[model samples]
Target: MKKLFLGFCLLVGIATKAQTVADQPFLQDSADKFSLKEGEGNVNLLQVGSDRNKAIKVLSSQGLMLLYEKNLRQDVQYRPLLDMNIVALTEYQGQFVYLTEKAVLSNAWAGKLYINHGIEAPKAMGMGPDFLTLVAGEGNFAIFKNNQEVWRSSIESLNPISVQYDPNSGQFLLLTAEGLYQVDSVLKTAKKVFDGSDLTAFSLFEDTIVLGTTNGIQLLDRKTFTLNKLDQKLPWTEITSVNNIRGNLWFGSTKGAFKLREDGKYDYYASKRWLVDDHVADIAEGPDGSVLVLTQKGMSKIDFEPMTLAQKAEYFQEIQRLRHIRYGFTSDLAMRTPGDLSTGYFHDTDNDGLWTSMYLAGELFRYAVTKSEDAKQNAYEAFEAMERLTALPDLKGFPARSFERDGYEVGLHANGFSEEWRQQWEKENGRIWQLSDDELWRWKSTTSSDESCGHFFVYALFAELAPDKEWRDRAIHQIKIEMDHIMDNDWYLMDWNGKPTAWGKWNPEYVNSFPINVGDRRLNSTLILSFLQTAYHFTKDKKYKKGAEKLIKKYGYDENANRPATVIGFVEGEDLSNKWNHSDDEMYFLTIPGFVNYSFTEEQKAAHFNAAKSHWEVERSEKNPLWNYLFALSGGENIDSEESAWWLREFPMDLIDWKIDNDHRKDLTKIAPNFRSQTYTEVLPGDERTLHLHNGAYRNNGGSDGKREYAPYIYLLPYWAGRYVEAISAPQAE
Candidate 1:
């Protein structure tokens, strides 16, 4: 199945609600205005709204706080003129009730009420004491005594849909989707405020009213009708909801939600993926500065500071373990080809018996610089083996993929196609042929799919090895060609091969190759890191310097685009989509630290730091432990902070964390198993899965010489980042 239909449906269900607008609203009259403020935490949350002559104040759950005019005497007989009942009460969303016979409030107010009510739908208001005024969603504002309406009215056209009493301005406000207006409840007359504007989402803070338009957020001064453009950063299609948490004015929009600066400026903070979707379904502050995000998929909570620290410790440890594992495991295998007298340490243990361990060897050499011994011997050996393999002619183009005794004779042909371009030319020029005696021989073959990473390793290995002037020159040429073809202006790499096919056709590429791969921009960061590492290692070259600079400017950071410092790629499920059902709106801020101190300018570093704070403040989700640790490493906070302590406790499962403690951290036997699994649906017949599995097994053993896994490259990360490298290079005896 294409999965597109299911994906679309899931996207709609979770993403549609993200387009609702909710911002601060204002209570104002012809000459006066006041703001609405909500309190925080364990303290009673105060709700205040005002019109021209009267003020309304409620302590929320604690009942009415105060209801005095701007200039009213404190000793005056105090009483609530209206006896409306609260229809709903929640931490963020609130509602009130009144009778239907009462005059309707403004449609603007009505729209606000409906949106705040969420999916519960409106409850019917009953007829009671004569209705004085009516407020729809913020709860009932008018009083109804007995069965008749409260206040006497002569204006025959007064049929408002929503009404609210402001305590600061001492006036009555009416709202309708069509326009916003004011009413004199005592005089029984109405006057227009703003007309012809679609005020779908609104928030009131003091005398200022925030309106969400189809394009962006608009701020209006209630007393003067002065309009101020609030959001000019990017396209803001919908304001799903707005609320004040702690001191931050949080905005939930169609394109994810953001936290605004408390100082009234437009500085924003949020998860990298907040803008990936068009609408933000829900937002709430979690314990210890964590953020709760409810999108279409489900609810996810993240604690950034703590999570980042934990993951960093974990990731660093994993790098160490993978390094040592590679080093120890490579001593166990024997090579099957005629060239190498040396034997590899790994052997097939889980699948059909066959030895194909060179891939792991190649990957290790690519990332050997991190481990000292790897840099000393393992890396050189792996390169030596690859060179020998490349030099040997493919006497049998198609060898039998089987490992059985009979299978050994199944292939008998020469396929000159090699891992390098030389073999490619030989295959294309018809110099390669298959013999009848060959077992794995096929008349035609396609360059291996999913081998782009291999090519990356090869280039990385070449650059790192730099055996001589000739080798270095060849490496430089190859690196440039690969970079020119695979990287776009956006700094995103094409996951597919760039080489022309038999038909001389190039594969189409996407701006981001995340989803099609493992949903991680590790490759992007890898390219960036590799370029920077190459530049740092080979300081004589200016091209590497330019490459590093280009990457920073192209795919670095953007508030409007909602890009965060660390990116964990995008997930492809229903609970993840935004209101627009567009994948472009989603991102996870991981991989930030991997590039945090590498190849970035001061401005870039500052931006990345800000993003790290935001990720910790709002984006770290419970579903992604890896994101938290990465954040912690880049946070630059105290190593023993509460967040750091939390990370220290979760050091076992995380490979990075485990390595930090020298692999002394123990895994829970009953909780998480140590075994790993991967499906090979596209496996070729007779291909040895056991050797592939073995090649990957040694990564966690503190040896950096595995052939299949990229443990060596990972093992080298700490060295480049100024961390421990010996963890990846320790000998097996030690």
Candidate 2:
């Protein structure tokens, strides 16, 4: 008995650890944390001390200067050393050696400049602690020792491009058109370590020597000197410069600069993130491990710091709070124009309730996982806003797109429109109504089928999870009214004009008319099933279940639900169904968890689960976190958990819709655009594509002029759902 009890305890311990792992945070937000100290002109050279407190020295067109921070502040302080056109600054044999366009000066920082005129200003130079090597013209080379010439030689066959001193071997490695050559101070002999042509630059490391060649970066073994090409994996082939700082390899190319992490993956920084220009001229390291990138335009310092998962969650939460206060309540705007979050000038999309419903679902999951009062309150507020949308219109359960004050203009269009323009817009936007005989209120009409999906989705969630009995009853009441209106109108959402809205028709006549392979047929059939199931789950009404069964038996709706997965790929001649509708994808996936969770029978659950799995298989290449989270919730696959985490991490923290232009980027791997999907091998989703509702993220072009700030719910839904399903672990406490 004691042994059995011990075994049970062991199992309990293992289960607890597993749950903790899932609860631990999986992503964090990271930005360039280093502040750049701009220079007057192009930076020629950068040097720093080994100590953390030491200041950095920079040589530029403005002259030599000391860059340091007085205290922990955002700005940097500079101290001038000499206001001269200095090209290079280096420490040689315990003295500061300064190179100019005309002459070489020593001890310039000590107010006593000793000039060396034996060798004219060389095109390329290399400095060691005790010796200096200069390359003049193409291959004419000379060595200097303490302001005196030691040796001079010329290898006219090899065109010398750059020079570097190896501290480990105490010798100069010269990069020439032939290969890398090691030369001694006497210049009597030169030994070729590697046979390589077109070497632009080179850096020596403990185990390998990295060469910047025309093809790409080449890694050569220190002893054997064999070449290993990295061009296939690199974003660009033309390697211009290379630097090794504390094991992190920084490569500069004609396209952009990238740092190779210890894990062997490359982190690319371009497009105004860490560079002022794509052409990287040189790279240096500061005392505190910051990277100094010198481009053709100027210099930029980037502090590469890894963010923790807890920080990411916190950032999203804060953004969610701000967006909710600004735009999530009342009539939720579909999208905000770039940099206009405060004034609420946004696009009043047709699916306001649908967007808010997804956000409400996220809050519901948050409440379920954390039991935080704030989560419950937020869910209640969004529910109230959605509930009011149904009450604004008099057509029984017909919910409006959104609502506004009676005096407010129909669309509330942007400024600078003429009075004549408002008259024509009134027909489209002006649908005012009075709910009561005495009171006046207006709401936008012409509701669609997608709105019904969102309505049922949130109503089902509220019915199942609302902490208050009154709120649960309200949810059920709302569901009954909406379902009754749809059924009584012959499975169509009739608008205020007594005509079915543009997309609200789901009757057999309309649904069955589409070809068997069409998306509308599958989508309408699947939406009706989810709607009926949700109504039955909340009301326990036999009529709702009977309605669903009739569709499956009569119109082959069950077969139609299975057909959506096959049509996920592009089909020739069927442009409407072939072009992936991301909005419909959003509506489809959001309905799955509720439909499956509240399913009435084992058979029903099986059908819904299989349909969801099939769709997920098609969407796996897109790597959408929300879809992956929903699939995992339905017990499809958890392998996407890590991928879901990656999506959340890749989401930009800057929610503004800034114009992103990738056309000029040479590092991007462009593929042929197709109807199936657009993809790039080099750029991530946020960088290459616009923010959209569906898997359109893989469609790589768009965001040229501006981007729209998506509602925070878009991110919150997947995050909280991942946590609720144990696909993402809670972050460990800091």
Candidate 3:
């Protein structure tokens, strides 16, 4: 992946005509990883009882613990019963009650401690209306009322797993693996109501008794005791816990937690994107319309907030301005420890120019549509970053990939090239690091097509969309100089050694040499043509126009550029040709707007538009906002804004590169690996998968240890692009 960074790392419905209404609020999911602060919450919130309350009581390895919302979703605080070894906990009459091996206590009454009626080592407990029940084993049970022992039972046939109290029925039900049993108030005797096995969880859904078995769900009429079984249609079959919060059915399984929607669909929350671990221990309702799920590792709160796309843009804009920008460039935050922001330090990448340009493009688009001063200032600052890149290397027209202060030159980061061979390769590729003339900085050499593509793309955006005339002039000038350098050098980016960098070649010699199945032929032809066309559009220079037309008419680059990406297949002997080059996709989409918008004639626009349409047809399945919006701007219709909105709303607020694995999911329909490496029948939603940027939405699984936090450009670029094209509207006021 080279500049694409192959760091051993790495989907929703469509909207066909939903963007017509401007400033409308759309649903967005905000994930609360329930990030643990030291000494604040329990290591594991293993809820053991059947108490269905917003205040969850549990038995942690640290002893007894009570989970509470402390600082919203950022910090879920837990109070542990450190001094006492408590076994079970429950809620009775709106107060927390607890049981130890020896006795029972209530946080509501400090001076009152009741004996457990010889139900030692209690593991399960429940309370309802005026009754408290504790179970130690299959046959041992103790019932208490108002701090007094009421009933004790020894029934050998009962193997109690959970205890639930139905408020409507005024009855306490004890659930065992064998069946459901009802306990009467008078005898405190247990009678079998339903005959079933492998039951794991129980909850009362209004007047109905909800039973969770290993395979499916069973609902019983609280008064009639009649049963209704539900089909095993769930994200995961093995149900570990079930709870009804405000009439909504929520279930926790071994894989993830899901909410049963009214339409029989489930809103699944899994992976590090939603929870700390997929193994959900328990789930409960939390403060502010949030759903709290306790996992094998820790807790997570899925917060549902109503906001417009504009509000979301502001949120991400603030995040980028706060933590990601470095020297006006969108930079990745490197973390010394996994998932720790305190250890994060902003760092540069080889494609800093490319990424900054994308961020800059989004800002310019934002300024054009919203006229926000902050957006304008953002564009100006990013434009300055692009300017600094051109000047840093001290090369007249060739920009450095990135630069660092003196003595910060690490070994070469060339993907296929080796460190041991750095010296031998330098002779051919030129010095990978060159000392700045001032002796205070070092610039990375071998500037790539990624940087080139990014420079031109943003330069065109700033020239066309930036509100300020002075800024537009500066961008237009840079566009001319950069294109002049590339064209004058025979369509190759020359390093200090006067040789083309390995990947900076866009000449017909290099491009046309590739076979028809190879992507570089089409991509390279499109790029150089776009560069020349954009240069001519602003500069109106005959050389730029002649250069673009020469490529199209003389070398037949028009044909090369119009082929669909589906034509790209495995070219057995070549390295890059062995797989689809995703970086090339970014290069093409970013360059196409410039190419199509600046066409020399109407016929040319029609032809270039054909090229864009072909690529979009291939990419349509991904439902990428940036790509789709770019297509809409290219005069295509029926581009789904719903898919665009779904992508935007489902994107997680968390940007940390946490390790994720979806390969083990049983709910997915697995497919044999294809050219794109697609593994699932359908792509999962944005919130459920890893933060893959443009490279993914196709890959099913990837792992990272919070070593790097991604820049929000991935979200911002598409959002503003969608906005500029009117594919997405401004946020509506509340």
Better of 1 and 2 by TM-score: 2
Give, for candidate 1, the lowest lDDT window spanning 10 residues: 659-668
- Cα error, residue 356 of model 1, in Å, equals 16
lDDT score at residue 644, model 2, on the 0-100 scale: 69
Which candidate, 1 or 3, would have the higher TM-score against the true structure?
A: 3
- Cα shift from native, residue 492, model 1 (Å): 28
* The candidate that achieves the highest lDDT relative to the unseen native structure: 3
Models 1 onward score TM values of 0.33, 0.78, 0.87
lDDT of each: 0.33, 0.64, 0.74
Alpha-carbon error at 611 in model 2, in Å?
1.6
What does each candidate score in C-alpha RMSD? 23.5, 6.8, 6.4
Q: Which stretches of candidate 3 lie over 4 Å from their true place?
A: 1-18, 21-45, 48-58, 66-85, 102-105, 109-120, 130-137, 142-151, 167-170, 186-189, 194-198, 205-238, 262-265, 409-411, 415-424, 571-574
TM-score result, candidate 2: 0.78
Per-residue lDDT tens digits for candidate 1, residues 1-734, read: 11111222233221111111111111110111111222322323222222222223332333433333432112122233233223322221222321222232222234332222121222222221232333333323333333234443222233334345554554566554556665555565556677635555455555676665555567778676567655544324465555555555566655555555344433222222122122355454544454544433223333344223213424443453443332122222233431122432232111110111223323333233234443434444443433322122232111112121222322222222234654555555542222223444222222221222233334443553444556545544544544443333233232112223231111223223334222233233433444443334333456555665554456431321124423432346623221111111111222233234332355655654564555445322221222333343344332223322222232221111111011211110122331121122121111111111212321222322222222222222222221211111211221
